[model samples]
Target: MRLSIRSWVKRVTITGSILAISLVSIGCFYEQAARSRAIKDFPAPGKLVDIGGRQIHLNCQGRGTPLVVLEAGADTSGSALWQPVQEQVARFTRVCSYDRAGIMWSDPAKGQRNSHAIAEDLHKVLRAANEQPPYILAGASMGGPYVMTFTKYYRKEVAGMVLVDASHPDQTARLAQATGEPASNPIPMAFRALAAVAWTGLPRLVLPDAEVPELPSQTAKAITAYQPTSLAAAFAEAAVFEDSLREAGTFRTLGHLPLAVLSRGKPWSAFSEAERAAGGLTREQFNRAEAAWANMQAEEAGWSSNSTHQVLADSSHVMQLERPDAVIAAIRDVVVRATRANATP
Candidate 1:
């Protein structure tokens, strides 16, 4: 018993020491992140527009009849993240994309992050930037709802929509159900708890040296210059919006808008051994989740007077990024169809 007690004490001490070291390391990273973000020298591709009190980074490129707008996923990606598609499609139509509030160079706001609120902010940015009415809103993952809400709130302004692996409410329920096994575990509760702290505190250290890969080289450098402080601001704004998404019936209004959904053909749950070996599982898991989410969004889209679905059997959730040529062709086809259907008289 005495030996067991001694061993237990030693283990406790070791654990405590490891925890202390971890905390110190995190603190150091945060400091570096902050310092890196503070310097004011970086290049930006678009004009910086001031909306209310926030400075939003924006760019309008290409030229054509129908204006195309690309919206990104959650906190993990930004408008610049759609580089592959933009580079290709810009030749055919006017393509515009901007970082949402609290992302990259976009100024963080103290406003609510709900679908409606975000839609309103986007409208304000569009107007201020003079992008004008008649927008083809294309979104991936979480961005689907933002564009959907925009069309719902600003109907006349939206011409059509393209949802790339959109989110659905039922998926959340399915995920809850999936928690019965280790395979479908909803990110460990302990990890979530730790993540909450990291979200708030780590920004203090990481923003300084943090590197966002999605942004164009120049834009990334420009945005990274704002580090810790600006990054924290952006993170806070996202938290507010994420909280709103968690609320019941936050995006039900999307059902009444014109939309098209393109789902990935592959499912992570169905990944094979060869696929896992090829890194498909790592990239395919998120796409699989998004594909499931698209199905969830489909329910609401069906209720809408104007909505359609498309399955990209040969692509992943990141069809736009992974298969730019195919994505452009899909977008062009959708636009043509929407135009034809709308023009029928």
Candidate 2:
């Protein structure tokens, strides 16, 4: 059941706060020209396949069965951000990482940026790229829900799964309960404002170069160049975050599928005194949220009858960057298990 692009993006909304704009900026045309030059200078490391009318960047490498698909966090982070993890996964099995709509080298989204559209774009891109499945999905952070939505719609094509400190459908409510109030999430508003002025080179003027020291030097350099220009994709995903979470919430069970749920050991919101003051989140509140998050991860393991849960005590929310070894081992384990299951007549 393919959804038309029109229905896929019925309504577009970016109702949120902003990071106060200052008019010290270049003209849109100048910034666009510079953006184009930046894109050319740091060319896409993968092929851009036409998914529907829009193009999506897909980086595929290595060769083996049960192809691994890497879904990045729905932020300015793109397929290239999975440098360390993908490199190792490629050694054992075929793997592909892609930039979602309006991200990196990919075209802007055609419609609503919910999980359904997100999953379909991936499906279309995979079809266009002729990447066969029985796919092994490894989703980190928000990528977890995107993975679930994919499995919800295309369960047969999925052989195994890994959720790395993934979001829970009830995370908003759960965390709100822990913190004693609903979160007035500032990330969306900040991204929305950033996107509005990114074309005018505001991001380049005020934003610092991306700091991803975990990635190789060249990959890190590419992120610095792309960060200022990719706010459109970041904002697009941020705007519909709740919608995506709700959509994924419905996909609760994975039945007999092989699964691995990895959660970070440290508190995701371990803010400093000043940072905590800004968000009105105290250290005690942060601790409660962390505990809630751990409970949620334990529950996620039950989604599949055959599953394993690992707590990477030294890792944080960005486990892919902080603990690529564990991430790779989990994927490889799932792939091996999926293969063994498939072979069982």
Candidate 3:
């Protein structure tokens, strides 16, 4: 009986070892395959300019005065995220969108991935690409802080600004109070887990098509294939969310800059039904929370002396994708105002 038990234990141990080895090998293979496929299938559609010994991808379309610069949300590939809106804005004036460092086709850089760092990189990219200033800077979500930082530091170069359902520095704390949950970010943890298995191509298998439903078919595929890099970049940014928020707070006002704050009209749907029920939150409670959120958005518009706050009645958080016309109109309004102002003196 003792001899038989010993043999069974040895067999089980060997099986486990082989299984672990096989999984690791498979992960490595998928990682390489995904990387290769991404390169071949989705080569950078824009010019890759070298900035500070690292390359950043910049895609420019259209031609006119008062150039429009699109800054995408955190972890998003700016060039891709601005696709639908970029094309429309190009019809009126020159518009450019770029990938931040370590995202999409941009080369990775080492440092604290805060809004200041991102804004600095953007300034360099614009200068290197010869996309001169007096730019109409438009940002969405986390991009809001970045453009705000840029506007603060390079005020003279900016003519106007647009915030598309932009993030606020007080968001985390407000959300916690609204939801009665602790203030913490689960996104970085989620990204870390995804990165761990990204080598296995699990992201491609599990990620929903709806995640980037607005992207072109090929671009969407490229994004899916490049999940590992995306997740890593996202993780880096999310890890310093609080720090970025604090930095963004310093840029308190827009001071007569033509600013358009496009707030989402839809209800916040980030919370799960189970969570709502568990919290004993009634419809009235939810509505109140949403009202507070909208109030906060309105407060952002108040930061600028010459700003207009518009709630996009038919749009979600990603107003650029869901309601490109609204975004375009906002940009056009800012441009027209800026042009008239420039003509004044």
Candidate 4:
């Protein structure tokens, strides 16, 4: 007894749907198991202090005057991201790092994830943790804007700043103009997709270890454990990027504060052959775009009356990972200058 065509099609569709649902359920179960394991294996190494209703994770080390505060890049886990640089800075002055709300071990908060809100959160966490200032704030990538916003609102608290391949306020527009590409962010969508898939435990199977740096076993495990949460928080932040950029623009100057801008000196060779071809850009065009980016970074150094800009020729955008010494040195320079300034008069 052969089935009719309509019956056969309906049977096939139902079978496919059932199979898909079953696979998804299995993936979700595995994901939950992984999450449970992560929670058990990796606990927060720092203090989780209540800031308003939400808890923020604060990690402080070393002991000295003029504390150093490290801010991680967009979507990055804070203290873990600063591991290499923070350890060395701790050798001299007290240094601290923290996870912003909704990242890592930090509890989620209700608000727009713009620079202003982020900076406010940082200020609240620091005060709650009893860390005093004049602080030497170091920001990398998007973290640059948050630190700058902090300096703007709490001018008296900040002693100095280090911008490590920091994002310029005009970076999006400038890059768009330079590359002849429209300024837009696909990060939110990308992360949202990842979040959905991650819940299915697909990420555990497909996520590569290539991007994970050589860190302590515990740190590595923690990072892996928190990837999904970090991605979601990053998506929130990325979604408000334009607003964040506008907020950053309101900050006019650093007002004679000590500043160090570390720019990436490498070329734009990270673009694959396929990507470059897709963009319809010649090699020369790519080089020009990179030069424009470096120029914009140099301009960021000029925001401070007393500022110095250095191009890290041997490094990429993630200079902390590539050349931790350079970042440490910049922080040291600003700290020494800040110390000298404090002693004078």
Tens-digit lDDT string for candidate 3 (275-303): 66765577666666677678889989999
Q: Model 4 off-target regions past 4 Å?
A: 1-21, 188-190, 267-281
Using lDDT as the measure, which candidate wins?
2
Model 3 poorest ten-residue lDDT run: 181-190
Whole-model lDDT values for every prediction: 0.64, 0.86, 0.83, 0.85
- Better model by TM-score, 1 or 2? 2
Count of clashing residue pairs in every prediction: 19, 2, 0, 0
Prediction 3 TM-score vs. true: 0.90
Q: How far is 115's C-alpha from truth in model 1 (Å)?
A: 1.7
Tens digits of lDDT, candidate 1, 1-345: 999999999999999999988987777676565544543454346777888888777777888747888888765346666777887778888888887776666766765666677778789988998887678888787777677677767877777777777655445556444332123332445444444554345544333443645445665555445443344433444455444345424545544445666776655555567755553244445455454455575674574566677676666666666556665766776566566656779
Which tens-of-lDDT digit does each residue in 1-345 have in candidate 2? 346665545432211112222333335666787787878788999999996677999999999999999999977768876889999999999999999988878888656888889999999999999999999999989999999999999999999999999999888889999999777763656667877877777777677877888987777777777887677777767778899999999999999899999999964445457866676777788778789999999999999998999998888889899999999999999999999999999
Model 2 regions lying over 4 Å from their true place: 1-26, 186-190, 267-278
